[model samples]
Target: GIIFFGSQMITRDWIFNEFGCKFSITIDILCTVVSNFQVIVYTVAALSVERYIDAKLSLTLNNKFRTIITITCIVLIWTMGLLMPLP
Candidate 1:
């Protein structure tokens, strides 16, 4: 995200050709979308934990199950992030 913004700021006149400009914009958009989605996911996770504690629910999970759930959530987040940039 910083890379995209910094590049644009440093080259206000656009040093790259048309293709470069388009590619840079695409990357910027992808980064922005992914970061936004991550923020949403993190916020939800935090809220879920807060609610769970408030309700005094069990927070226990087997190691394997926890790993699987974490991996699945990461994959889903990235998949959704990448798909969001599509036209």
Candidate 2:
């Protein structure tokens, strides 16, 4: 598979002290890619919640609490996405 070769290349094509970390990276990529659908679902859920907040009330989104909460949700979603994999 393309993924397998790409992962193997990182380990085989380069010399490093990682002791075939590329293999781990390959597996991680496969796992993460396969798991991405779930991630997208979560993202859509977050967006839906945001939409509900925007429609549920009459006040414009100028209040500190609403603004902060919206920003928090957005940031949390992205942060988790970025940090989803670690060894």
TM-score of 1: 0.52
**Which lDDT tens digits does candidate 2 get at residues 41-82?**
668998888788879863867678787987887777766765
* C-alpha lDDT score of every prediction, in listed order: 0.67, 0.68
- Model 2 superposed RMSD (Cα): 6.3
Q: Model 1, which residues run further than 4 Å from truth? A: 1-12, 57-87
My TM-score estimates for the predictions, one after another, are: 0.52, 0.50
List model 1 lDDT by residue over 10-51, tens digit each: 888556678876787777777787778775876588558656
Candidate 1: pairs in clash: none
Q: What is the lDDT of residue 52 in candidate 2?
A: 88
Candidate 1 yields a Cα-based lDDT of 0.67
